[model samples]
Target chain A: MAVPTTRTARRGRPGYDLESLLRIAVKLFNERGYDGTSMEDLSRKLGITKSAIYHHVSSKQELLRLAVGRALDGLFAVVEEARTVPGRAIDQLEFLVRGSVTVLADRLPFVTLLLRVRGNTKVERDALAKRREFDHIVSALVEQAAIDGDIRADIDPATTARLLFGMVNSLVEWYRPRRDDDLHTIADTIATIAFEGIRLPGGE
Target chain B: MAVPTTRTARRGRPGYDLESLLRIAVKLFNERGYDGTSMEDLSRKLGITKSAIYHHVSSKQELLRLAVGRALDGLFAVVEEARTVPGRAIDQLEFLVRGSVTVLADRLPFVTLLLRVRGNTKVERDALAKRREFDHIVSALVEQAAIDGDIRADIDPATTARLLFGMVNSLVEWYRPRRDDDLHTIADTIATIAFEGIRLPGGE
Candidate 1:
């Protein structure tokens, strides 16, 4: 499967490459659910033959794998990138929260699908395992932050991490990229609300 | 259908009632997608015939309606109870948060199913509408809190309400009723993290 470089081809028919096809597939999966969607549905939605879709991805499961893999890859990459440079544990944790929101916003459809996977099949189970690994890495960062005295020491680190990410993860349910609201503003608001509580300075 | 007042009946087969039947149905619905579960599946799991199941709820949609309605009723009651006495907006907001977490903990299965509804059927669409209403009421409280200068003024109240509830709502995904962790502590942790942020007092 080749990445789509151009939006259109010389032919009048709508031209779609692997990436474009997967985007549509992920959107459909999110709307109709993975189990409810079929290759025929994808074909009909794309206005292309199933053979054309098969030419890119082997099967429906492959599309599911590719879609969720995109989300997981982005998350793991954030942790990997954070590892190369040195910083305080709290700073690293902040970076992760910011980067995760960016990834979530950038790949909203894919991340939404990834989060909704129910582990009904082998492919879904694999995705769930990868998700757990990502969660573990984040949990460690929370522990280190607490140990470094960067965050409150009262709450358990694992539980703190879960609540923090839970807030961020809920973006998929209601967040829509607005023309006026950029991703950075959204990310900053999340960070502020998560780190500072929403209380006015010296008010609470 | 009559609500079960007694936990046990005189029948030798360990008689079940409507509330108990709905509990089992909700668990099954959560495990298997609501659309995927059928009366036969519920009967098989309950060790009863479909006819016996019909003695309670008329159909699967009724089961879903009853389950989600349970969650909605709890939320509405909280808001209704709050209106009886006058208090500061922030206090009202806090009360809503605390009450919501308690409700979520007490009715985890029902709320979990409520949150996961995708509006595929009329029952689901109705559930979604009720959820939106709940969000609106919370958002109003948040707006009032910001106006009262109890919370930060920089962020939009609607956005703050969404993220705050998002953090609280995520509890259904990971929180289990445990011997050591009491509901008040869990609710306090949520309220503290949300209103106070998790950072150290003097630390950023």
Candidate 2:
């Protein structure tokens, strides 16, 4: 679990705050990778001592927990919201895909780490389990879409979900937030291409 | 750039022996990560002295260069061959996509590093540049396919290429070799899902 940020009203060093430490750690982690970065590395980047880092958080793993937990929260929220929406299965799938890309674009670093982890640490293992949970929900939606006779039955729903996410996950590699190409546009384009390409039955 | 793996063959305590060391390094690099692993870690894994490692290769960067070069060769080969195939642009795109997946599946470690590198090192930077060249080629093919009116013309080629590779790159996360699932079937299914989706188009 993430360290309780909202409840911690007071701090030993006013300038060195929890939120700021997280921002610094995430940046360094992205630059050097999680395993490459050490507590000393974070302190050096922050212009503080390792003891100062300990003052804000327990260990390096705590930072990972906070970062990945935030990412998991964003994704799970999208899935839960998609489930309650009233529409055809394909329509719901479209909403889910669009929502996912937007979230990814917004929280790019956390999502990038979430996508890249190899289950080497407990935090990584937790992120993976949460990811599988998200996949399970999407698989169900794909199945429902197929049953609605909107998508083809030839392929399995599990396979379809993986393909859908494969496209979505690729965003971490190249997606840069631009003035012209914003998150909304990227999400809409991804959904349109995915839905148009896979909607069931041949084209007119 | 690689110290010419073959050229160093004559020197005993063999400079060429570095090739075997490089292979061992790349294998470890893929499993643990370049940042996560160390020279000492590599020496331990290879059952060789740290001095022995230096005899063949100068530094970790050389090993990265050799590994990424292998991946770039595989991908560029696909683009070069697809350009010569006798077919419409869409057919060529399909062939390229299928071939890219197969190549990635075959060279999982190299491509996995290619996909995972964040451009933090010179080796990663070079790999990213080569990857961009490959992307440019695929985007051109997507543009040609759109011009031929074989596929939908509404989506931009850049976007199409991202989605295409999204499906292909997702292979590293889940694909396993020597497994029960037929790769031929997997490749065909991806093509089907890409060209014609689960939903049959309106006309045919």
lDDT of 2 by residue, A15-82 (tens): 67898888789888887788889887876677666766777788889999998887899998888888
Candidates in order, TM-scores: namely 0.87, 0.87
* DockQ values of all predictions: 0.56, 0.41
Using lDDT as the measure, which candidate wins?
Answer: 1
Q: Model 1, range A133-185, lDDT digits (tens) per residue? A: 87888889878878888888887776778778888899899888874666787
Give lDDT: candidate 2, residue B100: 91
lDDT of each: 0.84, 0.78
Off by over 4 Å in 1: A1-16, A43-52, A84-86, A178-180, B1-16, B47-51, B84-86, B178-182
Weakest ten-residue segment in model 2 chain B by summed lDDT: B1-10
Candidate 2, residues B1-204: lDDT per residue as tens digits? 222233233335333376677677878887878877787898678665566676766777877888888888998888888889898777778889999988988888888877877687888898998888888888888787777767777677887788889988898898889767577777876887777765645311
Candidate 1 chain A least-lDDT 10 residues: A1-10
